[model samples]
Target: MAPPSTSKLEDDVSVAFRNPSHHSNCAAELDNKHVNDQDDYKPERDARVWLIFLALSVSAFLTPLELTSVSTALPTILNDLHGTDFVWIATAYTLASTAVLPMTGGLAEIFGRRPAMLASLSLFGLGSALCGAAQNVPWLIAARAVQGMGGGSMASLTNIIIADLIPLKDRGLISGVLALLWAVAAALGPVVGGALTARPGQWRWLFYLNVPIVGVAFVLVLILLNVRAPTGTFSEKMRRMDWIGNFLVVASSSACVIAITWGGVTYPWQSPRVLVPLILGLLGLVLFLFYEARFAREPIVPFSLVTNRTSFSGYLQTFICPFLTLGVIYYMPTYFQACKLASPVRSGIDLLGFCITLGPAGVLGGVSVSRLNGYRVQAWVGWTLLIIAMGLLSTINEDSSLAKTVAYPALVGVGGGIVYAVASFPVLAPLPVKESAHALAFFSFCRAFAGVWGVAIGGTILQNELSRRLPPSFAESFPGGVALAYATIPKVASLSEPARDAVRAAFAQSIAVIWRVMIAVAVLGLAVSLMMKAVPMHAQTDENWGLEKSRDGELEGREGTEEGSDEKRIEKESIEAVI
Candidate 1:
């Protein structure tokens, strides 16, 4: 394509800024009601905008709450279900969430954010209701999967909405506030679950609780949010969606989740049960990539975004942080319950050290990025704290004091808050205005996928260690030996003091292994962060500034050439097709 003359490019930008709504269609964005970089693009602080933000905040808090809420209540849920589907119960929702994420962008683009968000909330509420009514483990697992699909959409859209309304300069502060909701929810999920599971049938309340809360959010969104949608019939909208791509994404993700979950626990690493799904998943993912890049009319996740150096860095960091964070969130309770012999409620209380500090740090980090005008240095400090926190965690054992244990994980929570607050900006800030929503969808996909892997990794370690050690350790006085010991917590009356001590020792060692793995992961994350393009506080970067610059550079050589006219015509056609 021939590059536009400098004066002409300038003219377009000036006019576009002058009236984004009027000029948006000529270049690329049909639905960018407000361009992010223009002064007029700033989000309104009107009652309506804030009300919409309120609805978003409620769902933001609830997503993490639902995700982590099941951890502390697992033992009780397992016992009551009378089945060994504990891993499935835990992984199903996360897996569903992960699978749905790749399609969220396309779905939102076709349906509009308001409808997509409302549909996700409705699915989540329905899934929650079903889970509360479940009579068996399988039923509950299915419901959780359903719930997770909704959560994936909710998580993805909340940030998309922010990008939709708020300009880049002040987004960090608002993003920080949103991160606070996540921090609080993540912190409180297990506590709420533990408290709910205090009685015989109390676990059901965790799911039942979502009904009213989602209903409230649903009403808020219904009344407040009015997003722009394309003009199309129902069939046109459906046809425009990347349905084949969506199916492939779901299939590959499901297979990957299965392989990850069963790598060593359900089957040995070499067994077909593990290897087949693992290999199939890898191949399917490859096929999905090729299909999206070469064949799909509209890809659910744009391959171009992932290929960008800056965007890839953000997604990679997002994935690794959650993988490590959930590794701690899921397994720390095991340490408290088995080693310290704390009740579920008490163990959740012990976690307050980590939880209490996390939200403040996220809020601080988020606002600081805006005030300081950059993300690089804060990220460095955040990663350093995370690595330090992991190192401290490596020292914990069965005999560790409650205060020390609390302090170690508390450090991790703080670091997590700091790093994650500004993580998405790199991907978002450097993109074309219209592409930000797709980037946000990919970001959510990475985070949700990481949660599943985190749990799987932690569980694999704990289960492998317990399987290796429990039989010998418990042989002295415990008749049921390893199986019984691993199934029940140390506080159970059937286990004698010696047996309980042995079980606790084994779990503590396994948890130490988890911490070690996380240290390696955190170090890897640090290395990745170092290589990313640094956005300094003083850069004065625009949301879509680089895209225009890059496009012009690509077309520079074609300018004034004989082939220029044809190329320009093709480029314009491509832009219109996508829009």
Candidate 2:
């Protein structure tokens, strides 16, 4: 693959620009066979593009809503299902969702975006129906796992579809809109779940609610999402997929998630049950990486993606921001419920400041990046705000004012929002336009993977501290440890004078440790953010994957005509020179 001669490239590009229909022919003449630096390869803005985008936005909204809504209804679900092992309810969904993410890109590449999207939505709706109809703990956990698989895939597909429909320079606004929907859905989830759970036997509706929404997205995609896919027989498509690579990653992720979900909760961190899986999972991930780099023809994660410094830095920033943001979001409610003695509903209401600020900040950050054509500044501002906010949050105590409590978390939300909205820019900026699907699938994987660590770290820190700090008499009631801290929040408010005061102080002190750790994480995110170079964003779409088939066919015919004329002209010049 030698570089094209400068004169030759100039000739091809000059001819291509004259007739936009010949863009593909010109790209084919280039060494890389894809337009890399060109800014004029914009897709035609059609009504169908907006229609497809609307479908994707709905899909994005459904995912986080399902993920967060379940937390508030878990208690009610446990009681109704007679489940003592309530941890499995959440863990199952997380494990399934996280495990399936690495395979989504390959699936999309092999099966096509429309098919992949339709399949994910189908799984999601089926899983939701099963969850709503569950009779016992096992059934519900199994159903949740199914639901999670779909949910995770849906998240990845939404981002991938956006990349297909939108170019990098214009993507900021679309990303902002999706981020807004995601934040709003998250903010509404607990409220929606709590309201449903408050009524007897109504917790089922939490899962059931996703059905109609999925149906709408499903039909919209089935009809309107007519994007191009690789044309091949079923077996040929399957052969193109990186099956072994997918298996290795999925299995390893499941193992790691299980260990993280159970560590310091169901079992001691030192216990062989937790230690063995964690060790094995790490080794498996290493093996998967090796296989992808050395053997797999189509890797789930391409080495080109992380080998570039800017893209690699983007991945690091992506992982760290979510890791800390989710940690803060999970534990902040502990502060309100345990120390401030706010009820579950009240704590959710109290969290409105954080939730509401995040959506708009994300929108603002996105618009700024699009207009300014640089992401580094927003990343710096976000990480700086996060570090400051985490430090301020560490100062919260039982006696902290409502305003102090409200304002600090809101600051965190703002920082997290900006970082989250623009994180994908750096990841996509350094890669070829065709790599968007794989890159974004891994991007979604990073966010989902970070969430597990986020919750685990906060839970582990809080559990260990609560065990050491709570009174021996009070701690004795829960023998397995207060790792399930939310379960303990209700009992904390009902205790007598000295005991209640001691519990609240211990809870505040223990929770402060989480915020303090996040300050360091935020600082690390800042450092990672600096590693990203200001690579120019692409203004083009991958020409092969557009939805306008009639337009594409006409362009192809015109390109063939141009290419034939060029070949004839070259032959004529050769004959004349010989004469």
Best by TM-score: 2
Query: Candidate 1: where are CA atoms >4 Å away?
Result: 1-43, 473-486, 490-493, 536-579
What's the TM-score of each model vs. the native? Answer: 0.85, 0.90
Clash number for model 2? 0
TM-score of 2: 0.90
Q: 248-295, model 1: which lDDT tens digit per residue?
A: 878988898899788777778898999999899889989998999999
Model 1: clashing residue pairs?
Answer: 373-537
**What is the lDDT, from 0 to 100, of the residue 567 in candidate 2?**
53
Give the clash count for each candidate: 1, 0
lDDT of 1 at 392: 90
The 10-residue segment with the lowest total lDDT in model 2: 30-39
- Tens digits of per-residue lDDT, candidate 2, 233-265, equal 999988988989888888887788778767877
Q: How accurate locally is residue 396 in candidate 1, as Cα lDDT from 0 to 100?
A: 95
